[model samples]
Target: MSALDGLLLERVRGLWETVSGVPVTFPPPGSPAAIVTAPGSGLCPPAWVGIVSLGRSALVTAPDAAVARTLRQALSSVPDDALTCPDTVRSVLPVAEVLGPATLAYVTEGTFRPVPDEGDVEHLSVDDPAVSAFLEAAGPTDAEESGLAEVTSPVFVLRTRSGPPLLAAAGYRRWPCRTAHLCVLTAPERRGQGLARRVASAAVAHALTAGLLPQWRARPAASRRVARALGFREVGSQLSVRPELAHRPTGVTEGT
Candidate 1:
């Protein structure tokens, strides 16, 4: 790997270590599949499990040691690159529901190439009523999926000088590791117009200027495309699972 790639990998490992509240170690590239465990971690909701795969190595976080042990044994023989596959995860944790296989992409100042700001792009408080209305117009599913409401940073918007106003909006939530988790959304009608790219560019630039690593966790192809356009590198993936055992009667056991 290039020196830059090595640096980026270190940053990612550090971020996961903080998020998982445990040591995270990666095997050398092309090494046999390997995983590290973080028990009783806050990587996911209580009773849920989270897995992050960075090529030949992965980190698995579970609510408790018992669950972590079960996962470790179950996934022991799986290839590292297949660790994030939903089907593989589901087969091993059959009673659990999988949440994602989101592409975890990141961009550093050296890699970031901001899109040219077009039209009138403005920075506004995340709580601004205009932002709310825009999210509402984007529909419940899209709005919730965008996660714009969770942004702790200023929101960037591209709006129409005339007509229906908000065309697209973007922002980031500051993570504990100084990672900026990006959220971007474009009005359904305005999607193909490059508005998402414009607003997202502004948000990314802000994050970089603040000395934060910009992270893009994208599930949609279009969103991934926007991240790639801004020079974000897809270096890994993340998935969360919640096992049905978590909801069983207190006296119930796994063998039961």
Candidate 2:
């Protein structure tokens, strides 16, 4: 594998270790990398490189060899344009080959930094009655869902001092290798007020206290800014596709 290819493979391996709770060894030359886990490990698809690790010792499916080769080429040939959002994944894999419905996401990580002004954010218990209300108001987010499914702790949410309504919320899911996936969402009306950064900083602070590396996967410019302000650096990009579209052909357009 080329250097770029090795880097991409390492990215996925780190993610797998986080989610799998087992260290991922490099695949022998030309062999598929693998992981083993007990039930309830919470490995899922649409993660890095579109592979899922079942709790057992096997992968759900390996990438198509042709697709993998294409991706290797894409990673090796970075474009001159550096002013791109969601840069790395697209450089390595075309959307057309991703098929189904997919989204481009920016994956970032950083050493923890604490923000002094966290407002009146509370460490919400999972069973806190207000959590349901908050979710109802925030609508359904992948962050909230992941917290519900995989996190043992309550998510953190910023609330007004008097009324206790949510201004922003931050949560994380555990991964192997002392990593945590961080997510933050601010109320639509409360955006642009730096509320997101405050809550996210609090969450990152907590993750650091626990000795976990926080992973921030954001797609929006505003969210990316918040991540950067919290001292996170963009390390990679992720492409998430619906399972139904995983088998579709690339280089073909609709109505073609």
Candidate 3:
């Protein structure tokens, strides 16, 4: 790996280590996956188990020591590359419901290939009503998945010069280790127009200008394509798995 790649990898390792509250050292290539237990860590939706893999090294985190031990034993024979695969995880932990097999990508200023703005890109508050309306039109699944509403940084938006409507918007939340976790959304009808690239470029440029590493975590092929177009390197994968016992209903139903 180049020095720049090594530096970026260390930044990401530090971020996950902080979030998981445990050392997140990746095992050597072709080695058994390393496992640690870190309950209540920032695994989305409070997963019982989480796995992250960089290059050929992988780390598995569980909720407790016992679970970690079990996972270690079960996964000892699995290849590092297979650690993030849902089926591979589910085979060993049958009760696990996987949350993501998202690709973890990062871009450095030296590597960023920004797209030119197709229109005026405006910087707006995260709470802008137009953003909310745009998300509403995009639907709950897209809104939640985009994470646009949760960004702590200024939202970059693209719109028709004559109107208040948004064609696309992007922003980021500052994450541990000087990382900017990006959130981008484009109107469904406005997709394929390169609006996502435009707004995301603005957000990425802003993050880079502030001396922060830009992170793009994506599961969708289209989203990954945009990140690749902007020169983000896909370095790893993240998967969160919730065991059946941990699945609790928010509202209990009475006996019928």
Best by lDDT: 3
Off by over 4 Å in 2: 1-13, 16-111, 141-150, 242-256
lDDT of 2 by residue, 115-167 (tens): 79635778887567666666678666643532543454457888777986777
Q: List ranges where model 3 is wrong by over 4 Å.
A: 245-256
* Candidates arranged by lDDT, highest first: 3, 1, 2
- Among the numbered candidates, top TM-score falls to 3
Clashing pairs in 1: none
Task: List per-prediction Cα lDDT, in the order shown.
Answer: 0.81, 0.52, 0.84
Model 2 whole-model lDDT (C-alpha atoms): 0.52
Q: Write the per-residue lDDT of candidate 3 for residues 1-256, one digit (tens) a residue.
A: 9988888887787787677767666667778777887777674455478888887877777776656666766788888898888898777665546778999999988899998765589999988899889899999999999999999899999987798999999999999888899999999988988889999999999999999999999999999999999999999999888755443233322221
Please list the residue runs of candidate 1 whose C-alpha ends up more than 4 Å from where it truly belongs after superposition.
27-42, 246-256
- Model 1: per-residue lDDT, tens digit, 101-214? 899999998889898765478999988999989988888999999999999999999878786478899999999778999999998988877888889999999999999999
In order of appearance, the predictions have TM-scores of 0.89, 0.60, 0.91
